[model samples]
Target: MAAGQVDELRKRVNDDWERIVELLKQKIALGSVSSKGIAADHMKRSAQFVADELIKVGVDAKVVQSTNPDGSAGAWEVIGSKIVNEQAPTVLLYAHHDVQPVPDASQWDTDPFVGTEIDGRLYGRGSADDGGGIAIHSGALQALGDDLPVNIKVFIEGEEEMGSPSFIPFIESHREEFDSDVIIVADSGNWSADIPSLTTSLRGNTTLDVTVSVLGHPVHSGQFGGPILDANTLAAMLISSLYDEHGDVIVPGVASQEVVGGLQRDLDEASVRADAAVEPTYTMAGTGSLAERLWTKPSITVIGMDVHPVEGSFNVIANQTRIRLSMRTAPGQKPQEAQQALAKYLVENAPFGAKVEVTPLDNGMGWAMDPDAEATQDALQAMKEAFGVDPVNKGEGGSIPFIPELQRIFPQAQVLVTGPEDPKANAHSPNESISLSGLRNNVIAEALLLSKLGGE
Candidate 1:
């Protein structure tokens, strides 16, 4: 395709940006929080709204009730497809309609459901995490009209915020419709607002529950505290053994690798601290550049621990305590292997002869995109043209967990991880938002990519 064709696609997107934002705002207002706590009917409303909007743009769309793990009905997901020609390549565009629960509405500057535009950012629960991705797909389809270069398949899951429990079954049931040459997952963010990114790698996750038993029965802290420690204290010691003084995962068996791209120079230590809201008084943990620490290194956190409530304090030390460890493995590492290693480490490192039991929770594999894939190159060129800057190769410290499933089902398809998010998007947090320019450019980029794939 000629550069002029891409320019025309950009122009078309710019013209449709306002309408796209309005539709996105309406979708955001539906407040499709995931089924973790919100009602299923609420998610269905958002799914149905997206289906209606896509149908209006001439795409065949529908709201589907996902099948739960136990064969029960689950949350609603939307799947839509528009095929121009069988000979043309098929591209599956993926997003999520669900938003994280607004556990505390008081933390938000604006209503979580109402899209509030301020200084070029649209702030709301789903605005950046995925509402913007939906807008890009809808706007691109509208701009392309009947002149599409490739078949478009849209997959919007309603439970991504909760780790997409039913994602594999949902896509497996509709395998034929989703059989595509490429997948554009719009769930990640860019390196920065000025630099567009194609996320090439994501860390995998595995969980382990460590329980410590220091005594057969409760003991008086005042009498036995000098010679014996409580299970809670022993549990803390076991957790601390997983990390070094510098907060690095020092476990011998867990592996780490250097990323394809070195540290992202666009982000400095200060910027990262700011993004994570780390206090200035605290020191950045681990070693290497910020990108390496985040993207390639393994990290372990004691997400939860069971202990006696401070308000209901007891003079006696508890016999047993449990702590949940959530570990993020590097891309290309086997999560099961790491989990085993973690289990062994906790058992060996138990302090004061405390009996330790490690139980496996779950292991979700990570994804590493092939940068040399044709679809990937097409996306990079499209993003460069649309954003007027060279695109960056990015890695996500967080794991999608479901992307690998998509690959397992369609081994030949190239996955292009693209999104409209930036550092300040604040996805899953209070005041979540997406930059308007970023959203507009993302729409243009997708249109450009489709044109490239279709050889327009």
Candidate 2:
């Protein structure tokens, strides 16, 4: 592909910006949220919608169902094309159809499910996080006139927000169908607004729940004040020990890496007070880059603490209490191993006379992409042509567990993680949105990238 051809594709993308946004908004309004029990129906419907769109673009699209199905539990698959090109390497374009559940409508300026436009953004539940990305890639293919120079496939998932439990199993069963030389994941954001970024790393995550039970029953506080055991108090102590006074994770065995410069958060004294909800933001006490602490260090957060509360002013000692903890592990450490470390710390470090039970709920491994791969270089060049700025290399704190799976499956495939959204895109937050300018520029970038790689 010559430079002139890439420039022409970029111009074509800019010309089709409005149509892309409309397609995105229409998809977001569908409200596809998949969970363990109620995933199949919504997934099937979402797949149908994608198939229809692909067919409209003159691509031969079909819903490839999963072999294992439990009596209409909702079959999941992709609506895609295999642009047979023996001259070019195969590539897979990926996205997710499912979204996170919406918040109460009263909390937003407009309906959370409705794609509302405000201040140059389209606000909705899945607008920026994923729905917008899906639209951009689909539109890129449409603008390319259905005669792609390489074999292309779009693999969208319904379980992305729900930890992708069925993702690997599905992939394993359909491995031959989804094979590609490059995997392009557009579900992430730029480092900040107006700055395109290629996400080079993503920290994995694991979830564990701890419960402390004592005395087997709620005892009278006044009558047994001297010897009565408090499950709530013991659970609190177990959680508090997860971090040292400096807020650094005290658990051993987890990995940590050096951080890159310019990525640390510098909070003023006032900002610290407001954020920590106290007088000061507790420092980690150790010196390293903030990205090291954020992306490459072990972090334990108490997601929920259950305790017997006073609604009618009860004076009883509670016998049972529990709390959920989410531990974020670095790229090299296994999520399962980290969860075990957390469980061991909670069990051995609990207070005396308290029985602690630590249970792991879920886990997934972290991912790190090669920064110097062909896909990364091509994406940078495409973004520079579209946005007129060199893209930055970035690391994300969140995990896209499937990236590691893709790497393991296709060791030769180059992976790229650049997308249209930015820091303030509000993905997974109330009134989530995507910027029009960013989306337009990303369409141009992705189109250029396809032209660059899918050339004869």
User: Which candidate has the top score in TM-score?
Assistant: 1
Worst 10 contiguous positions by lDDT, candidate 1: 259-268
Give each model's whole-structure lDDT.
Answer: 0.85, 0.74
- Please write out the lDDT profile of model 1 over residues 1-456, one tens digit for every residue: 577777778788778777899998998898887845423677778889999989977789998888878887776888989988989999999988888778998999999889999998999988988898889889988888888889988888888888777889889999987999999998887777778899978999999898899888999999888778889888888787778888888998999988755544534777777767898789888877778788878999889999989997979988999899999998888899999999998898889778999999999898888867778888889889888999887788888888988998999999888887898988878999999988888888888888888876
Which consecutive 10 residues in model 2 have the weakest lDDT in total? 259-268
Q: In candidate 1, which residue pairs get closer than 3 Å at backbone N, Cα or C atoms, i.e. clash?
A: none
- Candidate 1 residue 294 C-alpha distance from true site, Å: 1.3
**Candidate 2 segments exceeding 4 Å error:** 1-3, 29-45, 67-72, 111-116, 213-229, 259-287, 312-320, 352-354, 454-456
**lDDT of model 1 at position 238:** 79
**Tens digit of per-residue lDDT, candidate 2, span 1-456:** 467776777777767766787778878877776653334666678777877776766557777665433334334666576676666778788887778886566777778778889988888888887887788787778667655667787787766787666677778776776788888888887755666777767888999888998877888988986676688887878777777776778787666664322343432445434634764545444345556666677777789988755776588888888889888888778898888888888888878768899888988788877655666778778788777777776777778888988888878888887666786676777778888888877877777778777753
Best by lDDT: 1
